[model samples]
Target chain A: MEKIKELDLPSDHISEFGDLVKQMHDVDVNMCYQCRKCTSGCPVAEYMDYSPTQIIHAVRLGLKDMVLSSNTYWLCLACGTCTTRCPQETGLLEVMDALATIAESKGIRSNAPEIAKFYETGLSNMRFFGKLYDLGIAGMYKLKTGKLTQDMGMGIKMMRKGKLELLPTFQNQGEMRRIFKKVQEVEKKARGATDK
Target chain B: MKYAYYNSCSLRSTGREYDKSLRAIFKKLDIELVEPKNWICCGSTLAHNVSRLLSLVLPLQNLAEIQKEGLDAVVVPCTACYSRFKTAQYEIAENPEMAAQVEEVIESRFEKKVKVIHPLEVLSSEPVISRLPELVEKDLSGLKVVSYYGCLLLRPPKIMEFDICEYPQTMDKILSAVGIPTLDWSHKTECCGGSLSITRPEIVRKLSRDLLEDAKAVGAEAISVPCTFCHLNLDVRQEEIEREHNVSYRLPILYFTELMALAMGVSEKDLLLKMHFVDTDSVLQKVVAR
Candidate 1:
């Protein structure tokens, strides 16, 4: 396994982000032995700058900036290959998620603009519509991320081919709104409990 | 028997044939499938992997809806949806506190409780398979198939305890009922790299190609699977894999329901062979050609 540089995290940093780090630790972050097995099994490691092992390491060190800004944080597909295969059985995926929560809480956006935009747009669309309206979400994502110009020809061709539907079929809009509202309340309570 | 049908995203969009065939086969089997009044994507592997809570919430909400209808179980045609629902159920059932939290969340939202079942489970049940012999209009004598269960159907067995995780023969047994022979290939429970097809095509291509080649090596004329995602990966990605690996591999992938429908004498057009990225006509035509 490649040796990872140990960062000398500031004393105040640990105190400031203690709760978030504690939540991450609750996922058994300390069990990692730098084996890199998680990285080896990760499907998205090739696409990420930081391997799964490195991301976990970053979380343990309380490097919020590194944890949030790294492409590994956003690029992770959460396949559970690492978590399932981890020698120590540490929930490496959950740790990454806790890191993501902290990142999102701090309003730290993904360095990969497209993925961040997709995440925001996809979640907001789901929250509002109670289900994914793929075409609507795609259009919104394209418009927000400014990639609409690059894929204009392809989008048009897909529309012409009848691959892209202009209208979405929603199942139950009122019920979905109720569900989203409940989830929001639950998450808010969970966050508040953690803060206390 | 009546079931709450949880049609995952693929069935609604890309794999509509699965939805159609499933409904048709159930009707033929004298089974009533009720689509949940309000359904959402089961979050599949993506949501589960990204956020365990989000993944659990989606399926738990669906299950709650099924419970509201007073149904004990749901028949999920999509393998990913089955896996997600089963996983959530297992987790919730194991942890009472978490289950309470989930129930509170779901009850507050939908005011219901729900159980889930995969179509394979329903199809393999004694009640359904006992009628198989009577329903076979065309025996699949010429069709040689390899039943690909994929990881979702069998893996994390606590969640998917419906069949033998290592070597499930439910699909094979159902296929044999209609006269199709199955190869005893060990790749039945192998991973197909599913949506990884989109995030990482190369890995999916390699994994899918290996499964197909193994099936072909064992003299399988076609590969049959219960998961639409597996069908998409195995069938659609074969072209790319063949080009990438420079191999002349052409394997027609069919949903287990489609095979069942074929044996039950459904027409080719109704099964939607034209919609498939890989042409099933060649392999299927041989079986029904006479």
Candidate 2:
């Protein structure tokens, strides 16, 4: 376990962020007691702007800006290590998801734009192909991030090995579109209810 | 003995070897695996990270297909896809509100509870386990590897509910039954920075290097994995890691299914060993067919 940097506190705290997290994930953000168990178990804790424990603390304190803008949630691999090890069973992984979802919805960009772009590019691949297109996602991601040559060698090697598919392989694009549309409608309804 | 097979997007592409080896071994063991029609992607971490409803519904779309196929269980070889199916099952069963929402979105009645299982679970259990020793046409006693479960298969224990989350031994037990031995090592269930491999290669490099270093420290010849991303991160990125760290750890990351296939007498061509970036010759050379 590495030492976590001090959490920079903000004076004005908003309660809606805490409520949003609790309502979205059904997790009690207040259950975290600074145990640091989540932090110790986290593989990317050292790379985080605010460690898992501090993120939960910020959520509980309603430090919406700090928690949402921090790179902690974006860097999370969704490995479920913290969720499994938490004594309080605070559902830290879900909390991280909720935070990222909220951040994306609010159009608040985090420090890690590549991570966000990865998710966006992957979702677009799913939308068009009804599944992940390996070559497409890699090419699109590189174009979006403008790091076109990052894995150029590796991509060619994989293609040579027949590991990279040249064409989209999955079916049922209509079903995927309907699923996305219905999900949007249902989420909008849920948000409307919550906003009330 | 029969199960529906859900080969994820990765399996059709980067993880073709895992798909080939798993199907080959299951057929040899006399266990039936069927592929349901109109199966779509499970939306993965992207769906879950953005919309909870989308995550649950995406997997349910596939489960609904399984239900229509009249199969009681589906064997998902990819641990990430397995986790999504399991999470959908847990969430739907536990919460009526979410279930109703999912049903509404999918526009179908998902009354039957289809069991979502991983290949590791099936292979580790009887009658597969019982028939394993008799089916061994190759001697794998010379090969020693560490069973890497990665993170998704076992963690967040309540949803997965398959094996010991922290120190899982299912893969180890299956290997032992096939005449191969697995060395006890830490970081069995540690994450390999899954999707971050695309966005944050440095993290994948560091974490995967840590896993390789640990496997080397424990005196294991290779590492056996049940997850596609772990295979991609560790095996495909081995050269990059070696170059970046300026160290040599040419560990061949094999799918546990590939090991089972090899031990069960499946040929190298059938298993598609050429797809791997890391040369698996060292591991394959040790297996002598009876």
Measured by TM-score, the strongest candidate is: 2
Each prediction's TM-score against the native? 0.81, 0.96
- DockQ, in order, for the candidates? 0.23, 0.83
Q: Residue B121, candidate 2: how far off, in angstroms? A: 1.0
lDDT, each prediction:
0.71, 0.88
Q: Could you say which candidate leads in DockQ? A: 2
Candidate 1: pairs in clash: B63-B114, B67-B113
RMSD of each: 4.4, 2.8
| Residue B16 alpha-carbon offset, candidate 1, angstroms | 0.5
Q: Candidate 2's fnat?
A: 0.91
lDDT score for candidate 2 against the true structure: 0.88
Clashes of 1: 2
Residue-level lDDT for B23 in candidate 1: 82
Best by lDDT: 2
Candidate 1, residues A98-186: lDDT per residue as tens digits?
66655665667756666556666766676666666656777897789666564465345445534345687666667666766676677
